[model samples]
Target: MKAAMIFDMDGTLFQTDRILEASLHDTFQLLRDEEKWEGDTPLETYRDIMGVPLTDVWKTLLPLHPTHVHERVNDVFQDKLIQNILGGMGALYPHTEDLLSYLAERGFPIFVASNGYPRYLETIVEYYALDRWIISSYSIEDIDSVDKGELIRKVKADHHLSHGIVIGDRRSDFKGAEANEFLSIGCAFDFSQENELREADVVVDDLIEIRDYLEKVK
Candidate 1:
């Protein structure tokens, strides 16, 4: 059977914890200085909710704040994220480049299926030049169902694949894979909690483990 692999961007492929945390703090402080914030924000709370959709994230993290405030705050956050990107704040996890190279060397097709903002995904892939190994990159903006599984289905059809898998670090990622009947490989080295990672068909602490497991499966 022909098979392909789909990867999530933030915690899966890129170690964005530090950059996200720093940018989020900057966003909150800048807004507070402007008198837009209701109160101080919890850093880890924001980090814990990282994988949720952007709109939902502000709603969950700052429900007491006005919705418009959340929107403006998010704009500042994304802007700072872009600045940090320019400052060289994020990088791929250990073994990520080597793993992608290995997969590409063997003619294996790999694609990004992330819930991250379309531009964020685009920037990271382009900045890292991951396109050389990645068949294509996808995000919520490109799919109609607004579900990663649906995105996976579309990619599957586009490539005429019989099987595909999701590699990510969150519960939603595993849920998307299960909903589509694809293997879910939880990446445990990043931000996800233990309970969330348990949803995956298999959990691995390193990217190379994914390559090794797939090699055995193939």
Candidate 2:
């Protein structure tokens, strides 16, 4: 049976922790300079909220400030994030290009299924020239919700894929795969809680492990 491999973008394919943290820091500072907030929220405190939508982030943080202040802050934060991406400030994880190329050479049907915004996904794929390696890409914009499992199911149906797997750094990735009866591989090199990683069908700390697993499954 042919196998389709879908990967998550943020912590899975690219190491955006620093970039995101820095962007948030710049955004909060900009808000403070504009007198939008009296103080800054630490980046560490916001790490758990990283993959969440911007609108949700605003809603969560808005309680700390007047409701009238959230709209402007959200606008400024988004502007700064866009600027950061366009400024050539972000980077992919180590060995990502090599791993992707390896999969492409092996004729694997590889796709990027991510919760990231569509524009950001487009920018990163173009910037990395990943179009050559990836068969397709999907973002949260393609779906109405952030449920990764639902997105995987949609991909499976749309592509007519019968067998496949998901590789990601979060427990939701594994749960999504399980929901669709697909194998889940947790990436240990990326950020994930220990309990979350334990739920994966397999766990690996390197890309070569994925290549090996694919071979065994085939």
Candidate 3:
């Protein structure tokens, strides 16, 4: 089978900073108005924890709150996020659609494997018309994934994918690719820290640079 292309949605394909900050601001306002939240929670905190699991996100964002409060906060956040996404509050990285189309046209099995919520992934794909190229997409929440590694494995198993490259901007992407024996392509143009992509099989400074690497693999 041809090699698949598994992409991380948040910081890789999608530029989520604006949408997430706007949604978090809205979520905090609604909760505070409802007397559920009482502090100034900056959006940077949420940004730093973007690629982690939702459970971890809540733990960090609402460390002092109880589990029920966490669930409530998450519900509000998810709702606000969806609203923002539909409102056109975010954008994909430059050339994101072009690259996907290029690969898909050449018979690549493209997929999105994200640590984000299922609805979030689905919303972006549907709203941005990414479904035109993506064969399938999966989220950690949808499959009860432990991390990006398991998420990748699940996509591979479910779709009968044998070979692929994992693309993202975080350590988990490289770690997951290593664990699954897939080549890792780390995107440096997004939210990655310095040296974060050091372990990646191939590190790219821009979305378009990925095309060069794919040529060798192809």
Q: For candidate 1, write residues 1-218 as lDDT tens digits.
A: 44578898888999888588788889888877887676766778867876777777888877888888888887888788877876899888999999999988887789988777777888888888999999888887677665667777777778787777889998888988887778899999668889998889999989999878977977
lDDT ranking from best candidate downward: 3, 1, 2
TM-score of each: 0.92, 0.87, 0.94
Give the C-alpha lDDT of model 1.
0.83
Clashing residue pairs in candidate 3 (N, C-alpha, C atoms within 3 angstroms): none
Q: Give the poorly placed runs of model 3, Cα more than 4 Å off.
A: 34-36
Clash count of each predicted structure: 0, 0, 0
lDDT of 2 by residue, 151-209 (tens): 88888988898988899988878998999999999988546667888999999887678
Model-by-model lDDT, in order?
0.83, 0.79, 0.85
Q: Give the TM-score of candidate 3.
A: 0.94
Candidate 2 Cα lDDT to native: 0.79
Who wins the lDDT comparison? 3
For all the candidates, what are their Cα RMSDs to the real structure? 1.7, 2.3, 1.5
Per-residue lDDT of candidate 3, residues 1-218 (tens digit):
77889999988999887687778888788778988688786677876766888888889987888999889888888888789888988889998988998888888899998887888889999999999999888888766556788889898889887788999999988898888889999998657866778989888888878888778755
